[model samples]
Target: MKILWFSNIKLTETQMSGSGTWISGMNDLLSTYYPDVQIANVTIAKVDTVREEIVRGRSQWVLPKKTTAGDMDLFVKIIDSYHPDIIQIWGTEFFWATIPFETICPNVPVILDMQGFYSSVLDVLYGDLTMQEIIRCFSIKEFLRPSSSLIALSRRLHKSVNREEEVIRKYKIISVQSNWVKGNVNLLNPKATIYETRIALRPQFFQAVKWNLNRMEPYTIFSTASMIEPTKGSFTLLKAFREVKRLLPQTKLLFAGSIQTGIRKSGYMRLMEQFIYLNGLSDSISFLGSLNTDDLIKAYLHSNVFVNPSYAESYSLILAESTYLGVPTVATYAGAMGELGSSKSLLYFSKYDYRACASKIISILTNRELAVKLSIQSITFSEKKHDPKTVAETQFSIYRSVLGQLNK
Candidate 1:
C-alpha cells in the first residue's frame, strides 16, 4: 500500500520544523514492522520550485508554500504520479495542506490527524491573561508585528477555527491523541469516525536512564516550549514560581527553548521579565536556549519536577516524553492536560490558579515518597501510551480498516 502524507515538516533532517517528532519513527516502524506498506511525505517549503528527495527508501517532496497557477498544477501532477492508496493529512492547523483533498483522487481514503485543534485552542488562546493583562502584554514589537499579541492571534485563530470546522465536517475519519480533542471533534461532526491514537517518541527518550532521585538536582524545575508565548502560560507559571520561591529560596527553574530575540520580543515577554525582576526571580530562573534531543533529555533527567503551564494542548509531546522518563510533573488543568493524569501518576492545578499550582509543585518537591510514587506511575502510564511497536501497529490497523484489508 502506498501512503501519501501532507505535513508541515520534512523528515529528512534531525531538526525539521513543526511538531511531528514521531513521523520519522512512525515511518521507520511501519516500514520495519509491516513490509508491505510504502510511505511518502509531502511538505511545503519556501523554495521557488518543487523538489524531491529519497530518505531511507521513502520519497520526500517539498513544494512551494505559495500557490501559483503553476504550483497548483505541479502539486496536482505529483498527486497523480503517486496515486496513493491512503492520503493522510497531518495537522489541520495548516489550511493549505487540505487543499488537495477533494481535488485529488477522491476515492482514496483520507485520515485527518489532530495537532492542537485550532477550534478548541481558540477557546484558550489567551491562557490566563485578563483584559488588563492583555492590554499590558501588548508591546511596541507586538504593535509592529501586529500578529504576535493575543488580540491578533484570536482573530487569526477564529479564521482557522472556521476552516477546522469545515475540514472536520468533510472528513469521515480522524485520529486523535487526546480525549479532549475527541470531545471537540464530536461537537463539530458527530457522525465522523474517531480513532484514539498515540504518536511514537524519539529513541533517546526510551533509551535514556529513568529518573533517579540521587541524580536529581535539589529544588530544580524544568519546563519546555517551542516559543514562550503568552498562550503557553509562561506568565501563569511565573506567578506560581514566585510563591514557590518564598517557600524554597534554593528552587531554580531551567526553561529549555529559544529566548525571545530583538524582533521576536513581545510585550508578553517584557511582562514576564518584569514579573521576574519585580519578584526577584532573576537569580533563580535560567533559560537554556534551544537544545537538541540529547541535551533536552539530560535536562529532564536532572530536574526535580517538570511543569506544563499551557492554557491548551491537544497533546503535549514534552509532558509525554518526561513522564516516560519517570519525571514527577505538575500541570495545569487546561486543554487536554486535565485528561493526562490519574491520582497515581501526575498532579494538576486549575488554569491561572497560581496558589494551587504552587501547592502542587511544592508537594512534589518536598515529599520524596510522593515524588517517587509519581515518577514510577508516570513511566507506567507514558510507556504504555507511547510504546513504538503498539503505536505503529495501531496506525497500520487504522489504515487497513480504512482500506477494507482487515478481514484479509
Candidate 2:
C-alpha cells in the first residue's frame, strides 16, 4: 500500500518539535517496518514558486508563508502522480486549506489524524465574527468533504471536534488511543470510530547501548520537550526543583529541549534564570539545549528521574519516552499522562501545584529503594507496550482497516 503523509512540521534536520519528531518516526516506520508499503511525506517548506503552487493547489495555511509552499505542492503532485491508497493528514492548520479534495482522486480515503481538535473548536468558540465565518467555511463542507476517517490522539481532542452534528455524520470512523490500545468506535450518521495509539519507541532508540547500571551516579531530575509557552509548565517544574534543592542541596536539575521562538519566553529557561538568581540555584540547575534522538536516549539513560509539569497536553511524548527508558517519571496530571499506567512507577502532582510536585521528586530522591522499584516498573512498561515493533503492527492494522472500509 502507498501512503501519503501530510503535516506542517518540518521533517528535515532543522525542525524541532513533537510534530516534527512524529513525522520523522512515521517515515521510519513506513520504510523499515512496512517496506512493502510505499510512503511519501509531504511537509510545508517555503521557496516562492512552490508556495504559489501550493496556494493554487488548495493547500491550507499551517505555518508562516515563508518556507512551506514546496512541501504543499509536493503533496498535491504526489497525490496526482502516485495516487496512493491512503492520504493521511497528521497535525492541523499546516495542510493547505485550498487544496481541492475532489481533485485529488475522488475516492481515495483521507484520514485526519489529530493530536488536538480543540484548536478548531477553540477558534470557533472564541474567535471574532470573521474568524467564526472562516472556520464555518471549513466546518460544514470543505473540511468534511475530504475525510473518510478521523483519528484523534486523545478523547479530549475527539470531544473537541466531535460536537458538530455535521462533522459527526460525514466521517465514517473516529478513534482515540490510550497508551495500550484503541478505544471503541461510534459509527452513526456523523459516524465515529475511536482507536488508541501509543507513542511507540523507535527501533533506533533501542539500539543505543544500555546505560551501565553499575556506574549510576547521584540522581538527576530531567525533562526534555518542546519549549512552547502555555501548558508545558516548565515554570512549575523549575519552581518544584527549586523546592527540591532547598531540601536536598546535592540534587541536580537538568532542562533539555529547544526554546520555542514566537510563543512568549515563559518556559523553563527564563523561569530557571529567575529562580536561580532569586534563590541562588545556578549551581544546582543546568540547561541542556535541544537533543537529537540519540542524545535524548543518552539523557534518559543517565538521568535518575524525568519530570514533565505541563499544564495541558494530549499525551507527552517526553513522559512516554522517559517511562520507556525505565527512568522514574515525575509528571503533572495534564493531558493523557495519567493513562501512562502505574502510578507506582511515576510521581505525579496536580497540574499547577509546584510544591506538591517538588515534594514527590524529593520523595523519590531521598529513598533509594523506592527509586529503584520505580525505575524497574518504568522500564518494563515502556518496552512491553511502546516498543516500535508493537506500534508499527498496530498502526498497520488501523491503516488496513481504513483501506478495507474505503474499498467496500
Candidate 3:
C-alpha cells in the first residue's frame, strides 16, 4: 500500500516543532515498519538542501496575501504523481491540504490527525492576531464536511469542540492516547471506537549520559519546554520559582528552553531576568538557553526535580522525557498531563496557585529519599507507556487496521 502523508507545516531536520516531530517520526516509522508500503510527504522547504520540488505557497500567519490558486494546483499535480492509496493529513484546519484530497482523490481514504484544536492553538501562538484573524485561521469549513476518519490527540480535546456534533454521522473514529480516550469517545460518539496510540521515548534519547551523582546542595529545580510564550506557562513557573527562592535562599532554579530572539520572545524570560535582578537572585537563578537533546537529558539527570507549568498540555513530552531519564517531575493537572503522573510518578500542583506550586517544588527538592523513589517509579512508568518501540508498534497496528478498513 502507498500513502501520501500531508503535513500542515514545513518540516525540516533542524526545525522540530511538536507537530513536525510527530510527522517526521511517523514518516520514518511507517517507512521502516511497513516494508510493502510506500510513503511520500508534501512539505514546505526548510532549507536549500534539495531544491528538487518547490511548491511556492503562502501561509496565513507568515505571508501577506492568499497563495496563488495556480501554485496550489501545481501542488495537487505533484501529489497525484505519487499515486497514493491513502492520504493522512497532519493538520486538519488548513484548507489547502483538504481541497486537493477532496477534489482530486475523493476515493482515496483520508485521515485527519487533528493534532490539537487549531483555534485554541492559533490564539496561543499568535496573540497579536485579531479575533477575526483567529477565527479565519482555524475555520472548520473543510473538516466539518464528511471525511473518511478524524483522529484527535486527546478525547477531552474531541469533546471540547462542537465539530463532532456536525460530522459524527459520517465520522468513523476519534482515537486518543489511552483508555481515557475510550470513555470520552463513547460519550462523544457512541458509534466511534476508542483507540490508543501511546507516546514513546526515542532510542536515540537513551544515549544521554545519566548522572546519578550526589550533590551537596539542598535543592536544585529545573523546567524545560518549547520557548513559545503564551501557552508554556513560563510566567506561572517564574512566579512559583520566585516564591521558592524566597523561602529557601540556598535553592537554585534553572529555566531551560530552545528559543532565540526572533521567535516569540517568551515574555517570561525578560520578566524573569527582572525578577532575578530585583530580588538579588542573579547568583542562584540560571537561564540555560536551549540545549541539544543529550544536554537536556543531562539537565534532567542532574537536577533534583522537574516541573511542567503549562496552562494546557496534550501530553507533556518533556515530563515524559524527564521520567525516562529517571527524574521526578512536578506538573500541573492540565489536559492529558494527569495521565503522565501517578501518586508516585510526579508531584501535582494546582494550575495557578504560586504558594502550592512552590510548596511542591520545595518538598521534592528537600526530600532526597522521596525524590529517588519517585524517580525510579517515574522511569518504570515511562518504559511501560512512553517507550518508543512500544509506541511505534501501537501506531503501526493502527495504520494496518485503518488500511484494512479501507480495503473492506
Candidate 4:
C-alpha cells in the first residue's frame, strides 16, 4: 500500500520535540516491519518564493506564505504524482491543507490523525488571560513573530472549526493518541469513527541502561515542556519548587525546554522569573533550553525525580519518556497524563496546588523504597503498553481496516 502523510512539523534528524520524535519513530517502525508498503512523509516549509526542494533528505514543498490557493494546487499535483492508496493528515491545525486533497480525491480514503484540537488548547491557555492581555501578547511583533503568525493562521482556521463536522463526517477513520482527545473529537463529530492509539517511545529510549537508585544526584528534579506557555504550568512548578527548597535547602530544579526571553518574553515567563528572584531561587533553579537526545537522556539519568506540573496535555511524550527511563515521577492529574502513568508508577498531585505538589515530590525523594518501586513499575508499564512494535502493529491494523471499508 502507498500512504501519503501530511504534517505541519518538519521532519529532521536532529529534531527533539514530541511531534518530531513521534513521526520519526513511526517512520522507522513502518520501514522496518512493513517493507512492502510505500510511505511518503511530506511536510510544508515557508520560503521567500514558492518552489519544491529536498531539505535534509526529505521532500519539503515551500510555500510563499501561510494557506494559499496556489499552495493547495501544488499539493494536489504532488498527490496525483504520488498516487497514494491512502492519505493521512497529521493534525487539524493544518486543516486547510487537507481540504483540497479531500475535494480532489473523493473516492480515496482519507484518515485524520487528531493530535489534539487547537480550539481546546486556546481555551485552556487563554482561560486566565484577559482579552486585552491576549491582544497584547500577540501584538509584540519583534518578540512574537512566530506567535503572531500562529494567531493569524488560527483565525483563518477558525472558520473551519465548525465546518470540521462536515469534513470529518466524510472520513472513515480518525486517530487519536489518548481517550481524552477521543472525547474532544466525539464532541465535534459524534458519528465519526475514532481509534485510540498509544504513542511509542523512540528506539533510543529503549536501550539497556542501569538505574542507580542508591547513587542519585542529591535533591535534583527535572521537568520539560515544548515551549513557555501559560498552560504548561511553569509557574505552578516554580511555586512547588520554592516550597520544596524551603523544606530541603539543597533542592534544585532543572527545566529542559524553550523558555522565551528578551522583548518577546510572555507574561507567564516574566511572572515565573519574578517569583524565582523574589524567593531567592536564582541559584537553585536552572533553565536548560532545548537539549538534544543525548543531553536529554543524560539529564533524565542524573536527576533523582521528574516533575510534570502542566495544566493540560493531549498526551505527554516527555512524561512517558522519563518514566520509561525508570525515573520516578510526580505529575498533576491533568489531561491524559494520569492515563499515561498509573498511581502505582506515578504520584499524582492536584493541579495549581503548589503545596500539595511539593509535598508529593518530597515524599518520593525522601522515601528510597517507594522511589525504587515506582521506578520498576514505570519501566514495566512502558514496555507492556508503549513498545514501538506494539504501536506499529496497532496502526497497521487500523490501516487495513480502513482499506477494507474503502474496498467495500
TM-score (all chains, Cα) for each model:
0.94, 0.75, 0.74, 0.88
Which ten residues in a row are the worst by lDDT in model 2?
A: 145-154
| lDDT digits (tens) for residues 239-313 of candidate 1 | 899999999999999888878777678787887888899999999999998788888889999999999888778
Total clashes for model 1: 0
Best model number under TM-score: 1
For candidate 1, the lDDT comes to 0.81
Residues 187-262, candidate 3, lDDT per residue (tens digit)? 5567764356766454445555443527423478888744334366665676787888887778887778665452
Runs off by more than 4 Å, candidate 1: 15-18, 68-71, 225-227, 405-408
> Candidate 2: lDDT of 292?
69
The all-Cα superposition gives candidate 1 an RMSD in Å to the true structure of 2.1
Local lDDT at 168 for model 1:
85
Instruction: Enumerate clash totals for all models, in the order shown.
Output: 0, 29, 1, 0
Better of 1 and 4 by lDDT: 1
Candidate 2: residue 87 Cα off by (Å): 0.5
The C-alpha RMSD of each candidate to the native structure, in angstroms, is 2.1, 9.7, 8.9, 3.5
Q: Which stretches of candidate 3 lie over 4 Å from their true place?
A: 8-19, 31-35, 46-72, 93-100, 118-175, 178-194, 209-218, 225-228, 258-269
lDDT of 4 by residue, 1-408 (tens): 888787776655554554557776777677677767677766667667656555444454445556553465676787787788888888766654347665787777888887665555555654344566455545344254654433554574476565555556566678989988888778767887787776866767877473568666858999984335567777777878888988899989998988676776755466556678999999998889888777788888888899888777888888888888889899879778888779898899987787888998998878899989999999898778788778888878878888898888
Q: How many residue-pair clashes does candidate 2 contain?
A: 29
What are the lDDT scores of the predictions, listed in order? 0.81, 0.60, 0.59, 0.74
Pitting candidate 1 against candidate 2, the one with the higher lDDT is 1
